[model samples]
Target: MNLIPAYPEIFLLIATSAILLIDMFVSDAKRNITYVLSLVALAGAAALSFYSFEAGAVTYTFNNMFVSDPMSHLLKLFTYLGTAITLVYSRQYIVSRGMANGGALGGEFYSLSLFSVLGQMVMISGTSFLSIYLGLELMSLALYALVALRRNDAVSTEAAMKYFILGALSSGFLLYGMSMLYGATGSLDVNAVAKAAVSGTIKPTVLVFGIVFVVAGLAFKLGVVPFHMWVPDVYHGAPTPVTLLLGAAPKLATFAICVRLLVEGLLPLAIDWQQMLTVLAVLSLIIGNVTAIAQSNLKRMLAYSTISHMGFVLLGLLSGVVGQSSNGAVGAYGSALFYSITYVLTTLGSFGVIILLSRSGFEADKLEDLKGLNQRSPWYAFVMLMLMFSLAGVPPMVGFYAKLTVLQAVLNAGQVWLAILAVMASLVGGFYYLRVVKLMYFDAPVDNSPIVASGDLRFTLTLNGIAMLALGIVPGGLMAACETAIGQSIGHALKNLASIAA
Candidate 1:
């Protein structure tokens, strides 16, 4: 088998091992070596992904378990870029909080992050349920410890405990679902399962139950309503860098998993799943938007906001599903795909700003903490204003387009009622996002509120925040990318399933 396509992950594996060895040998005085090495490793991985993308589809090793098709390569590229940004913004935050190489933290944080990125790579390239779960576990386990890295802090410990316990429980549900799916189809490959789904030999009840459980597990990761209890506390109490990871990279992997499992593995059952997602989307929108209004902590509020965004995504996903519903056959799959892509960029920018609000012992997580931000730093206030405005679905902001695209997708599929609910919730959600802007620009600063960030941190945050505006203003490139990626997944699955059936 060809190996060129596997170069990125291969680089990541070697780098991860090297960092571990170096961290063990290096003295505390030279511990910065580990940090520097981690950055270089991530940079290398990013380069490899980009180079592979230019060369086009390349499948290498394990009979297709690790293919670097355009969709996988593109998502992997974004994942690494986001990881690099997380490390850059987090370096200073980790240092200031004494969360690097001292107390309960060290080079391990960076190392774990590398492994998590590796997991995401595996996730995107996964061709079978086995590969998907392997990636999911690797990512989740690293995240569990990362959340609790600040061992001495009670809040951190509690958050880690809750996340770990809940994460474990969710994994069980997902595994059970996979087991049922395998039993019904007698295959572990997603394409094989899709073929079986269309064959009509599998028991419908078993298939439905399995699909529900799998979706349930995914909902936990996506922070959808009913499965979102862990989000606010975990986001609030975990170290800020860890919170950034929570809000950003994982979304890509989780969405990838959902696409592979639901659309690819269970394509024939799309109608059933669509109805289920409708219920989830509406409830998540109502709860996420309403509860966010009461949150005083910025991280917690954003966590709730993320839940609402998940709802919007679910709405789009359901629309995509209903395209097959005999009612005009208008498809929203393309729209759903675009919505996930933009959501990733928008949310990452929003949280990156929060990570940079470091002032020695302060973490700037509370809404009141941002009082009169404009007076202290108009540039930051402007950046944050862009993020908040985008999230509020205001015109010309990326968040606005992200929401509009999904709503349009739903309406296209004739799910007008669901589209209307999403619109109303978007309006409700706007209140909190605008409140953040009002706090930054309209309110007076708390007596000593002077926000300061490291130079690198400030620069990256600005770039990330500015990107939202850039993408929102001219989103065609992103829109095309999303359509291509989603179509890639669908086409691949259909081709494989058709071949298997014949």
Candidate 2:
């Protein structure tokens, strides 16, 4: 089998291992080497993904257990970029908190993050249920450790325990569902399962049962309602940098898996899964948004906000196969893809600012901590304003367009009620987002300490914030990229279906 399709993953594995080994020999004063190496590894992996990407090419390897296409390439590239940005935003916070002590903890943190990124890459390229499960576990295991890295913090340890227990339960649900699918279809390959599903050989009851568990597992990963018990605690308990890592990049992987399982493997059973997603989406919107308004902790608020944003993603996904309109499928899925990317972009900046405001012996995680941020740093206040407006889907922000596209797709599929419900949910969520802006500009400073951040942190945060407005002002290029990636992925899926039929 050809190996080019797996080159990026292979390179990451080697680079991570090398960095881990090298980190052991370095002193605390020289720990910057390890951080630099980690960033370089991510950059190299991104370059490799870009180098291998083609407009419409799809490559499958390892007996078709892995597949690389435009969707995977685009997602992988962004995942790499997101991880790098996470590291950059996290460096000062990590150092200030003494978590980067150049000992086992620091080394483990960086290495584990690399492995987590590697897992995301695997999930992005996986074409078999086994590969996807393996990747998910790798990522989850690393996150569990990262959450507990500040071992002395009781809250951090407690959050890790909760996350581990819930995460393990979710994994069990996913595994059981996969086993049931295997029993019905007699195959572990996703494409094979799809063929069996469409061929009318499997029991409808068994398939629907499996789909329920599978969707539950995926929803848990996406932090949607009914399975989001861990998000607020984990975000609130974990160190701010770790929380940033947790919130940002893995989202691309979660979305990738959703596309693989729902759109790729189980398209034939879309009606059933779509119904389930509709219910989940509505609950997430209502619960996540309303609950977030009650949260005084900024991190906890964002965690709930994440659940609601994911609700919108689900809306786009469920709208894709509502009827027999092929164009509707493309528009709906493309909109979801665009929404996911923009959400991650905005989330990185939001957390980056939080990290910037944090210093030794202080955690800037409370809503009150942001009062009169404009007085502390007008530039950062402007950055926060842009991020908040974008998250609120206000005008001239990419988030507004992202929501518009998804709602339009939903309406196109004759889901007018769902679209209207989504609009109402967003309107409600806007209150909390805009509240942050008002606090920054209108209130007096709680602490007159000036915000101090590394030059790298300030530079990255500024660029990251500006990207939100820039993309919002001119979203055509990114929109076209999403459409093209989704189109190519659909074409590939169709080709696989045709081959299965033959």
Deviation in Å, model 1, residue 157 alpha carbon: 0.5
Against the true structure, what is each candidate's TM-score? 0.94, 0.97
Q: What alpha-carbon RMSD in Å does predicted model 2 have with respect to the real structure?
A: 1.8
Clashing pairs for model 2 are: none
358-456: candidate 2 lDDT, tens digit per residue: 898999999999999999999999999999999999989999999999999999889999999999999999999999999999999999997788999
Error of 2 at 402 (Å): 0.5
Stretches of candidate 2 exceeding 4 Å from the true structure = 100-105, 492-502
Per-residue alpha-carbon lDDT of model 1 for 121-150, expressed as tens digits? 988888788899999999999999999998
Name the Cα RMSD for model 1: 2.5
Worst 10 residues of 1 by lDDT: 322-331
